[model samples]
Target: MMFEYMDKMVMFQDTPEGLTADMGWLKEAGENGWELVSSVPLIAPNRDGIAYGTVGCQMILKRPKPTQ
Candidate 1:
């Protein structure tokens, strides 16, 4: 089987709007035949070289490749 992943999901500090926005993307992905596999929050060091915790998120989804 073959599949594809979409990592463009976004979240703004895990706010309510951010949650809803990501949910919207997830919903759209399902409509396009993708099944959610995982969702992970992303964090990175700031300019001061310190992690401020979850700053964003990444979503993993996959579905069978279309017949060719």
Candidate 2:
């Protein structure tokens, strides 16, 4: 069997609405058969070298390869 993979960079504001939008996007992807495999935070360290919040995330998805 073969599979296809996708890597998406999702960004949103640090607010309730932003989070809700993100979840909605994820749910849409799920409905289309994109299985969530991993999610990695994309954060920038502050001047003090401490990471507090994430600006976005990298999502990894996979699905069965389609055949003709």
Candidate 3:
């Protein structure tokens, strides 16, 4: 049988501040059956510090059983 699942895409800034917010949201979603699938920093570093970019977080979750 093909089970149903849920997917969510979260985006955040490359800065610490942005990460903080993103983490909080991710945590809440995880509690609801959201499993982290993949993540990547959107910043492309050059000779300087972090380049202008954002971070992307992806998560997958299995559907909860229906309450009958």
Candidate 4:
């Protein structure tokens, strides 16, 4: 069988300003037959030899490839 694939993701910041989530986008992707493969957080390291967490988020999505 043949298939097609697609990807979508959402992210935010860890600032004192604020953060936003594009749920509608994810919803639309799902409506388009996309599946959530993974949800990972973006991180960074400082000179303290320790890793710090930020408001960054990485979402991986994929859908079955379509046949011609």
Top lDDT model: 2
Task: Report every candidate's CA lDDT.
Answer: 0.74, 0.82, 0.58, 0.69
Off by over 4 Å in 4: 1-9, 13-20, 46-49
- Model 1 TM: 0.69
- Model 2, poorest ten-residue lDDT window? 14-23
- Let me know the TM-score candidate 4 reaches against the reference structure: 0.63
Residue pairs in collision within model 2:
none
> lDDT per residue, candidate 3, 7-47, as tens digits?
66666544755463346766777676656655545444567
Candidate 1: tens digits of C-alpha lDDT, residues 1-68: 88876666576644665533445766787899989788898787889989977767787888888879
Best by TM-score: 2
Worst 10 residues of 4 by lDDT: 1-10
Residue by residue across 1-68, what tens digits does model 4's lDDT show? 54455545456744476776657787888898888877887676789968865556677777777665
Residue pairs with colliding backbones in model 1 are none
* lDDT (tens digit, per residue) of candidate 2 on 1-68: 78899999888565755552256777888898899999998887899999967778899999888987
Off by over 4 Å in 3: 1-3, 16-21, 37-54
TM-score of each: 0.69, 0.70, 0.39, 0.63
Better of 2 and 3 by lDDT: 2
lDDT of 4 at 10: 55
